[model samples]
Target chain A: MLSIVAALCGLMLVATKAFTAEQIASNHHSYALKTIEHLLQQEVPATFSLTDLPYGECDNYIVNQISAAGYVGEIQYLTVWRAQQDTLSMRVVRHSETPGIGDFIDHQRSPWITQFDFESAQAFTTLDGVSGATVTSNSVRRAAIGALKTKDIYCG
Target chain B: MGEPKTKQTRTFSDGVLKRNPAWIQLLGLCPLLAVSTTVVNALGLALASTFVVVGSNVCISLLRKFILQNARLAVFVLVIASFTTIATLLLEAYAFALYMKIALFVQIIVTNCMILGRAESFASRQSVGKTFLDALGTAVGFSIALIGLGGIREILSQGTLLAGAELLFGSAAKGWTITLTDGGLWPLAGFAPGAFIVAGLLFALVKSLGRASTEQPPMQLKGES
Candidate 1:
């Protein structure tokens, strides 16, 4: 009986893994492309093709995706470069900040995240809360600065 | 305990309505109430619970002859845990977002009295076919209760139906969201306390209807006389 139970249980799990492996892999691979498309304000790409510069790319500009330590965990963001352009743009991809309060840093949750769309991270270094999410705001500020530093590390 | 012969139809209907694991029976209210904040969440959890219950019940019924009387409960738990693991893995591999949304709750399904109760009481004594029917009925009842509570909370809290539908149903379900009010009010309805109030209201509504339908007078107390 124990053997029967073990065999059945093992078979079921093996079958389940076999079935869902493809979709799980697909969802992971598409994460980068999805973030890129959202930042660029473009249609879903027919194919995913990314060009990494010494710095992050905007168009002909540089781009970088970096993670910064927040209150609890790392906050990931995408930075697009600006050459002739005056302002740089970045979007939060994931974070582990408190919900309802800190989540304001998310552009989807609130437009407060749009404050970081700049050529440099200087102005946003001491931004006040558009709402009341100061901790999350600071994390986003740090992340933007982190994105800028990547250029120094690579190109400069 | 000796097996009490039950009519096949009654056994099935009892699990579905008269003894709904979530609503009428209120067997597994913790995860049921917690995750029923949205249709997508409710649907995902319901699917997971059903898969575990049905799978466990079938296994218990088939193994009744082989399992010792004293060890039945222990084995039943082991069986329930195995199926729960299978359900969790399936969710992670195929429905990644849904898996993350109901992350903590999936394991809690093992402690759900509904699945264990059915395994020990009915599945251990009944035919595998009959146990399957009972599990199906119970699962359907659970799904209905979850969807009802989820609908109420979502409509009241966010003024939307099927918000984040893609979490369960995939990308095509992205457009399933429906706007209710200009913006939904009573956001608290999606929180823990809100679930308690809504559950109380549901019980009240059911009790009132039960009262309205019962026409017989109270039975006399012969023992006192």
Candidate 2:
């Protein structure tokens, strides 16, 4: 009975996964575009161009996957950096950081991430991290600095 | 031994009030407090939880006779987990923005004690029809508790109601936001500590109301004199 139930449950999962995969992918694409537009402070042009970066870039917006050692584990996020403007935006794609305290890294959770909006790489150096979440703050800071370094390598 | 049948309405009211899983039983407080910062988020989690609870309850009740005592819990977990995954997938496809905000809590529904408790104590023993009503009532009760906290927190912390209704209710709900104040009056209400404080207050209020309803005039007996 256990095996049969498990098999049935597994089949249902497979069917649901196949059914929703395309929609989920499209949702993710639109969300990424929204984030890019938010960072650029402009609407993403239809049929925007992509670059050869690891995570691919949208026109001037270079997207990089940065994994920084957070309070618990590596915090992975897609950083949208505009080399010309020296401004970058980060959206946490995954993390196991303590919720409530360390989750302020998520833009939806708090405006702490907004401090990075439209700010130059140099300005990030002096920015204060969230109180009581020093490790998380530093981890995000490292990712921002890493994005800045990427501008030098790819844009140059 | 077979138990006496209860009226469907009584079963439902028991789940929603007298035996409310959240307020009285205090099951599933994790997601209850975590994803209730906003009305939209609370509703998102509530709907996801409702789907899982109702789906798992019906499935478990139908299969209860076939499930052995030793393997009952394992089966319940599998069913609940499957329903939770289905809910997560649907939310991702249809309500992606709201899904992102409360995805973690939605995923955690599989482990919510309320659903598992119902499966063990009610669904596994009761008839499917009864189990269905119980599950629906519990879900509604849980939703009320979640939304109550969500509404209070959103108002106190952000000074608005349904500020991001669009995330869950679509484009039509974009105009649903009602600003009550300028926001940031009590920012702590948006955090975990505030959840606990507000929940404590709400529970206290519910307890007072419950006591009031139970209060009655003294009864006279023939031999009292």
lDDT per prediction? 0.74, 0.83
lDDT of 1 by residue, B10-108 (tens): 777777766777655667888878788888889898899999999999989989999988777778888898889878878877787666567558868
Which residue pairs does candidate 2 place in steric collision? none
Off by over 4 Å in 1: A36-156, B1-6, B69-74, B92-97, B164-178, B211-225
lDDT of 1 at B70: 75
Q: What is candidate 2's lDDT per residue for A2-85, written digit by digit as tens? A: 998899899999999999999998887777667766655678567753333334453466776667999988887777776567
Candidate achieving the largest lDDT: 2
Query: Model 2 compared with the native: what TM-score?
Result: 0.83
Could you report the DockQ of all the candidates, in the order they appear?
Answer: 0.24, 0.60
The number of clashing residue pairs in each candidate reads: 7, 0
